[model samples]
Target chain A: MKLELGKLTIRDIRFSEESKISEGILYVSKEDLRRVALTEEKIKSADFDIARPGESVRITPVKDVVEPRVKTEGPGGIFPGFIAGVDTVGSGKTLALKGMAVVTTGPIVNFQEGVIDMSGPGADYTPFSKLLNLCVICEPVDNCEKHQYESALRMAGLKIASFVAGLGKDIAPEETETFETPDLLTGMKAFPELPRVAYVQMLQSQGLLHDTYVYGVDAKKILPTVLYPTESMDGAILSGNCVSACDKNPTYIHENNPIVEDLFKQHGKTINFVAHVITNENVFLADKERSSNQTAKLCKMLGLDAVIISEEGFGNPDTDLIMNCKKIEAEGIKTVIVTDEYAGRDGKSQSLADADKAADALVTAGNANQLVRLPKLDKVIGTMDYISKIAGSSDKALQSDGSIEVEIQVITGATSEVGFHTLSAR
Target chain B: MKELTILTNNPSLKESLTQKYPYLRCGIEYRDVNFLKLLELVRDEVHKGARILTHPLDGSVKPMETPYKSILVEKSDPGLDLNSLDLIENAIMSCRKFHFDERELQPRVIKDFQIIDRTLMESAIDTSGLY
Candidate 1:
């Protein structure tokens, strides 16, 4: 399949009389945009706000960050399966709004959400601080269930993103790049002399609030299977998880996955970029073993020399990481795993809950348990009333002086295992 | 009374332990014993009801923490038979393994493996508990 991803770098975002893009500035009609999210009966109230880079703003209880993009010339629409109907995508042209994100806020399930600081010492630890965030704060109707609230907030974010991206469909793209992958037989035949490399991408599929969706299907039901590299590139996978603010891959990261981009960068020059082996991190031990066993068997059958396995969450998923590594290495295939650490406040405890000598080639994405003091921002977009009860905070988190103490885990995408950020520990 | 078995290969250290932790005065008994002899004693004690036993392990290593165990094993001689001590004797399989299909660069190469995958895991000496 072939996909041409067009990019338009957004320099500024502002609310105006009508939504349009001009001179790299995105003007949004707040009333019209708010209408898109408020259509859902579960959402009681909806509002649109923009958080610029280097602003004195703090967004709390963030659910997901989505990049606005429209499928201009594809077989299926953007974000196919969730907002768009389930149809084969990633074969034609898709336009992505560069340098900005649609951040969804209003964590009705208080502790399950994350924080985003547009500027501060806290901002330095997160990637979202660098983007021009168009945050959508939505409140669920009275007595809404946590699951219903999560969906309400998630759909609101995607609806806003889809509405904004549709505006860029007819505009001239600033840049365009094409990516293509051949069938298994052809890929092997073309790069007969190069080493075969594939990616074993583990999806966060534990359950309930901690879930990820693929083609609008729950990831927990999926066994180990193969995917074209471009499938994830065109919004085939999305995050619906409330696992941890720092480590969970938001919908934005899944669409612009760094591993997929970097591996494709070395497609034929250094290695034969093969297919992606997708698997789930189920809660059951038997499910973990079965998924990993199937993943390893596929790697061996594909004649892959090596694979890069990237994980989504921490704790229970660490076992799945080791199992995939050990079982794959047992088939004479070298594997490297990407993951983060939760080594305690002192940074002296064991990093992972599981380990194996077979998992030797490993890269850590920093320790999420490190504490930091977030200075008060001039403007707070979401409420700070629930800060003390959050996972990374204590009763003393909200100080009298207006500042708060919290672990980096409270910050969105602070310690991503997909090598998305620069923070790491020795 | 709990028997404090000192499984030591040094005679002077044994003498030092016996002198340092003297009986009746400290309300405890110290016995000098070999490593194999301690295993035989443990096997005999297993048949009888053992009680109120405690052994302080090295704080650095916790075996249970790493369930899929990987340890550094030295090339040593075979151990004593404990069937005579009323213990069920399982047949000894080959302890030397190459579960990784690794090519050896030199003789007597040391390779690490997850303990459960190793043939001798059931019989493997989990010395972490014994120090």
Candidate 2:
């Protein structure tokens, strides 16, 4: 018998065997073949471990497998690019993107309306330091209580002093307690007249804008911070523990601040990302069953790497949030969870899982550079309509392979009209 | 009654209670891991009015026990596995948060693990009580 082996394509190979042996072809004589068979029998006496990248199979007669001369693409070419989405928990997109899971929010009222609010004096506008490299970004500072803030800032040499200290006035109640730390002085100074424009400009001057990944843009404008200020309450409202007042418009906060527009104008080219407003509810399912289903579904939607529970544990909204985060983090994805709270130390209302989930979501969302919005819909039909909206009324929904596909689940009627128009338009 | 103590891997949450709630007197014991056993121990303790604690790096134990005291309402911990540890960790983290005492809670780092580096352990340390 004749045996042959050779490379077929990039990272691929083929082996073939034939009954007739040819001269000058690394062939063995009949006697030699019998001797080889005897040698194989003898080799069975010894034990050895073998490893191979691709599958290996044994053939009794050593039949020939034709070596087809075909072009092939390596793993590098076929691998999927980053995929992300922001949808309501029960929407079932989570199940679609399981492998590339980046950031997932809880339930939301309006994901497209979501925004990032960093302006005014109380914005805590600190330059991006190298120490914050490992720290995940969180919103609203409510998640980061005084203790958690102090700990996070401890290495950075910043501390949480008094919340009411720097508001341009001596708002510190006459009986307000004070901390004996440098943070009090620094915070007081930074707060009174925060140069929001100068601060972001200076940071941008340092090439921070270029360093960060910004995602999303419409044909007309970039949507870096989808300003859903309704969920973006003022820090003062957040400070008062009045959860109901947390919703504010991001555009209002941005438009009101001359500094924000100035920074945007300067770095808008570099920070060409779009924003979508989403509610805190989108990320946090109302119940455990919904949370798990949403998580599992989202994982499927995104194609996440691995889903592991947080060191803090599992179940509940926090656990659901963290597990979703871990799935993204394992892939080294950047996410950002836009919210009005920090990762508090006390595992009281929200668990570390919850906080970390927000952090991971923010970091990954930031990295993916995709704007997702989760809005609450009063009507079930509205959900389908929203999906249709995202799918595009003028264009077909593009698939992972860039092929046009139609989803007829709830948007069957909408897709029909779009499909007819698309075909006729084509 | 026999003086029973709850052992957890989370020394930070354990230490917070000692400083925050003066009325509650108990020691939070730290163990390397039996993880499941830790949950059983926490449940055993919370039932007997014992304090429980947790850390992000302490690994999973059980869910947190809810509403231990009026101050410690809305505590939640869902252990990695469906066990008691998740309950206890959530309970402790929650208690440490909403529970208001005249004095602020102070959390201290108790270095018990030799394998875990300082940074990993430090992150796990919830120093919220100190603030």
Candidate 3:
């Protein structure tokens, strides 16, 4: 499959009477976006705000961040499962509004939400701080359940993002790039001499607030399956998981996955980028064993020489990572696993909950327990009431001077296991 | 399906499981213990030949971050399942790695933890087909 991605560089975002992209600036009608968000009855109120790069703004208790994208000339639309019909996507032309994101925030549904500082020491840790963010703050109706609120907020963000991205459908793009992945037989025939490689993406599917969806199906219910590399670019997989902010793959990261992009760069040149394998991190031991067994079997069936496995979240998922690594290596296939560490504040603890000698080739995305101090900003887009209770934060997180001290885990994308951010250790 | 028992420290989880699966009310065990003690209870059950159906450290909320945890296990008295032993032992070891401070959390936040724990256990039960 081949996909042509057209990029519309958004230099500025402002509230205007109409929503459109002109002269590299995105003019959004706040009322229109709010209307889109309020379509869910579970959401009692919806408000819009903007935070730009170098602004003294902070967004806290963030649920998800999504880049605006639309299919210009494709078989299906972006976000195949949720925003669009359950059609197979990943071919033809798609337009993406670059340099901006739609960030969702609300009352803390769970403690696994995150924070994004637009301009401060904390801003440097999260990539979302650099983007022109259109913040969607939604409030749940009275007596709304937590799961109901999460679902409403999640759909609201995706709907608003899709609504904003529709403006770029007819506009010309500033840049265009094409990505193509051949079928297994064709790839092997064309690049028989190059090393055959594939990527194993582990989706977080614990339950409730922690889940990922592929084509609208809960990932935990699905077995190990193969996807066209280009399909993910067109939004086949999306994050509904509210794990730790540091390592969770928000929808934005899924739309712009660094691992997929980097592997594409080395495709046809150094390796025969064979396929993309997706498996889930379930809570049941039997499910874990079944999924990992199927994953290794799929890798062996694909005749892959090497595989790059990326984990989402941590703890019990670490067991799945090790199981995949050990089983795949047992098949004589070289495997490289990517993960982050929770080595404690002193950096003296075990990095993972589970470890194996076969996981020798590993890439660490820093430690989530590394402490940092975030100075108070001039304006706050989301409530700070939950800051001290978020993951990696403590009771004494908020300082008397209005600043906050916390582990980098409180910052979104700080230690992404997929190499989304620039943090790495020697 | 085999006889499955759910061990949880969260009161909300125990109530929900019993309410949802009324027939399995006899198997749901609710203990008034902290997160670590709940895992110790599961470990003790594992030593008595109970197989861990779900992972002890299931959620990504960290070991000590959330005060509630629910684990599902097969109630069969088969010989010791080494996999269950290793998993529970590792979970206990992982729990000790983190520093647990008794901070007063908001009532709403505590309720949120209970709901999350219940949801995770429900997922395991859904897949386990204990009904």
Root-mean-square deviation of each candidate, in angstroms? 15.9, 27.1, 1.4
TM-score of 3: 0.98
Which of candidates 2 and 3 reaches a greater lDDT?
3
lDDT by residue (A1-426, candidate 3, tens digit) is 999999999999999999988999999998899889989999999999999999999998899999999999968888888889988898999999999999999865657789999998998899898899999999999998887888999999999999999998899888999999998899999998999999999999988888899999999999999998888887789988777899999999998988889899999999989889999999888899999999999999999999999999999999999999999999999999999998888889999999999999999999999999999899999898889888899998889999999999999999999999868554
Candidate 1 residue spans exceeding 4 A from truth:
A424-426, B1-131
Scored by lDDT, the top model is 3
Q: Which ten residues in a row have the lowest lDDT in candidate 3 chain A?
A: A417-426
Model 2 Cα lDDT, one tens digit per residue, A1-426: 000111211121112232121221111132322232223221111111111121121100000001111102111110011011221111100001000000111111111111111121101111110000111111113333322332222111110111001111211112211111112244334434332111110000001001111111110111112231111111100110000111111111211222222223432233221211211111111222233344444433333222222111122223434444444454543433222221222212443334443354321101011112222222120113222221111123333452222211111111111011011112
lDDT of 3 by residue, B1-131 (tens): 45667888888876677788876533778899999999999999888889988889956788868989888888776788898899999999889888655799899899888888888887877776765
The residue ranges of model 2 lying beyond 4 angstroms of the native Cα positions read: A1-268, A277-279, A282-324, A327-332, A337-426, B1-80, B97-99, B102-131
Candidate 2 chain A weakest lDDT stretch, 10 residues = A200-209
Candidate 3 DockQ, CA atoms = 0.76
After best superposition, candidate 2 residue A65: deviation in angstroms?
75
Predicted structure 2: clash tally:
112
Find the 10 residues in a row with the least total lDDT in model 3 chain B: B17-26
Tens digits of per-residue lDDT for model 1, A1-426: 889999999999999999999999999999988799997779998888999989999998788999999999868887778888888887899999999999998755445568889998988888889999998988889988666888888888888999999999999799998988889899988999999999999998765566788888878778888888888877888988865788889999999998998999999999998988899876544567789999999999999999999988775577688889999999999999999877766777667656789999998898777889999899988888666645456556777889998878788888888877758554
Query: Residue by residue across B15-117, what tens digits does model 1's lDDT show?
Result: 4323533541211222344323433344444345331121111001111211122111111113432322221110001011101112221211111112111
